[model samples]
Target: MNASDQNALVIEGGNQLKGEITPQGAKNEALQILCAVLLTEEKVTIHNIPDIRDVNQLISLLEDLGVEIHKIGDNSYAFQAKEIDITYLQSEEYKAKASSLRGSIMTLGPLLARYKYAKIPKPGGDKIGRRRLDTHFLGFEKLGAKFNYNSDHKYFEIDAHDLRGTYILLDEPSVTGTANVIMAAVLAKGTTTLYNAACEPYIQQLCRMLTSMGAKITGAGSNLLKIEGVEQLSGTTHTMLPDMIEIGSFIGLAAMTQSEITIKNARIDELGLIPDIFKRLGIQMEFRNDDIFIPEQEHYEIDRFIDGSILTVADGPWPLFTPDLLSIVLVVATQARGTVLIHQKMFESRLFFVDKLIDMGAQIILCDPHRANVIGLDRQIPLRGIKMTSPDIRAGVALLIAALSAKGTSTIYNAEQIDRGYQYIDKRLQALGANISRI
Candidate 1:
């Protein structure tokens, strides 16, 4: 955290917020789709784009590559990549900006497929754990791209004279890796089959946008995806889905704060397992068409198994509970009426933030790096506000929830971490009666 990042959020807790709010555009999805803009020479207009640090950094990177970007609206933009300067990627300044965001890694596929070569610096984003790019590199290698690592430059260089698609089975369901492989395979010479692929809604949205740009892809929402290489891709307009993670965060916030809140245009059908997972934590939500209405409740009891065992909330790949929301869920469970184990199976360092919650008076047993058991307070005890640092994006929001529900004022340092994913979060929460001020 630098001088700019020294900004903190001061929150007055114990407020019952009541209002309706809509989630911003999907940040993860925008990262992938924006990289896809490099595939076409024509203009691509993307709507519902979130105004955040990561997305803005990526858009700046696009500009450095000579992509003509015009802001059509506050949340819309038009991009044209007809005059890409791939050599700019090798500059020190460009490398620094590229390395500032993890999403910059996605640019590898589009660069390799279009320019036949790409140089990417090691990516930087929320230091949650070791996020490997091996799946992406290996996937590109399967599609006939040669890879080399320059230890001196601390970057990876890939080149492909002829990219011919083939069968690829990823070692893990890496979302960004899947998007990279799909983007590269879409412009290859032959058909591609990807098994054990990440099928998150973001990936599905990326595939749909690619399909609109003239790519042939099947089995979008499933782990197995088949893509037939096309000679060229045309530009097309794409509208992103609401950020499901933010929606889940808001749902958890409403429940933990005992507020009556409604999330508008939630796209409930696409939010697989998210609502049910919250419902398990004792959140009662009603779906009205596309919105979710969560009313104020005095008590919410965690559901137990039919065998009377404590329920465990674990994260897995898509169609399962998203790992991103596990932190939020863990925070919400602190106010519930029963005990539930939070198993964060994906990232190792994610559950380490439980120490912050425990310091704030929540009863949490940190079993290991991968799991924690949270015993609900049942609203019998109000959490005392305490100063803490924001660890990562999801965990930052979780801490914000804890701060809002705490008995007194709490200051959260490293506000930039929260700004990376959320758009004007403090102002948005303030609209709903949250006593938060960004300092």
Candidate 2:
């Protein structure tokens, strides 16, 4: 479990996996909700939390800030931020941990709301492209906060004597930015209106949890939100929905490997456009109550438009297809009976990993930095596995899926990138009868 370990995954391909699996809690939601715990001094109990590297590191950072953490179980915890010491944020040890994950930037909002001042190191995460923090800082400034960047220390600092809520429109529907601004505005002094806000399930969950903690928030699952700031917030218990990205990855894995698998307790309602998008790629899935069942198939064909044009799968903001699942879709399309285009509009560099797929004997044309054309082989020629390194969380899972359906053994280096978002992925895959070993 050491973060510094050079881990790798050795996967044996061509296995017919079967059984039922349940996804862990949503990692994206847990990051936002965990940061929101800093808004109150009372103990907040959170259930269905994912035990992943990024979440664990964020919890450690919270502990450094003097938050009292109690482990209720493997998937539940109680967090109390009564005696937080803000000074620790400037220390080298704190900086090292905070700069390792992008979730650490979320701490700025709560700290500014509760203590009137905050310091944060430049956050780090998957280097897909330019993930600008302009929306977050602009929203903070709109709420009457002063922002400054320290060039020497490579950090950001903000101070607000009295945060006054006002109407602000974000340039883009940035999920983390919206969450940060909403958390700060909840305790501000006036009515705050947020337009063009992200309506992802993660943001909606964070808003609902805040509402339970005595914050007045309206428009839970919409692009517009209204928050009337209160003087204080109390603690509340919240449970995260299942990780939709993980569920999508499982579906791709099942289809690629010709496996019959059921994803239990998938929170089907929250998964907007995911299942339908897979259906567009000719993936057959049945909704058995709350679970999704994918049966083994010899072949699944991609659906074209009514006019017989090639279907292109692109990513965008909420209510549209998420960028996280595009990688999985690309991998699944490799074995389908038709051609499709995968467009990753959000991050330019994400499609670079397709080179690895092409090297594995798949037919992929790197259209550009944002698009790739995948021509399905109809499983006529199975993919030959080769050694490669994982680039990011989504692509890591995509590579794993490709490896599972490949014709030979494959070894993936930089397995920690996969571990960052997935919880015990190797063990879980092994439970489903996949031959994957971690070393």
Backbone clashes in model 1, listed as residue pairs = none
**Residue range 22-48, candidate 1, lDDT tens digits:** 999999999999999999999999999
- Candidate 2 CA-lDDT value: 0.94
Each candidate: what lDDT? 0.94, 0.94
Q: Model 2: runs farther than 4 Å from truth?
A: 1-5
Instruction: Put down candidate 2 lDDT per residue, 1-439, tens digits, no spaces.
Output: 3453469999999999999999999999988999999999999999999999999999998999999999999899999999999889778998888888899999988998899889888899997998999999999999999999999999898997789999999989999999999999999999999999999999999999999999999998999999999999999999999999999999999999999999999999999999999998889999999999999988999999899999999999999999999999999999999999999999999989988899889999999999999999999999988999999999999999999999899999999999999999999999999999988
Per-prediction TM-score: 0.99, 0.98
Cα deviation of 231 in candidate 1 (Å)?
A: 1.1
lDDT, candidate 1, residue 264?
98
Error of 1 at 198 (Å): 1.1
Q: lDDT (0-100) at residue 73 of candidate 1?
A: 93
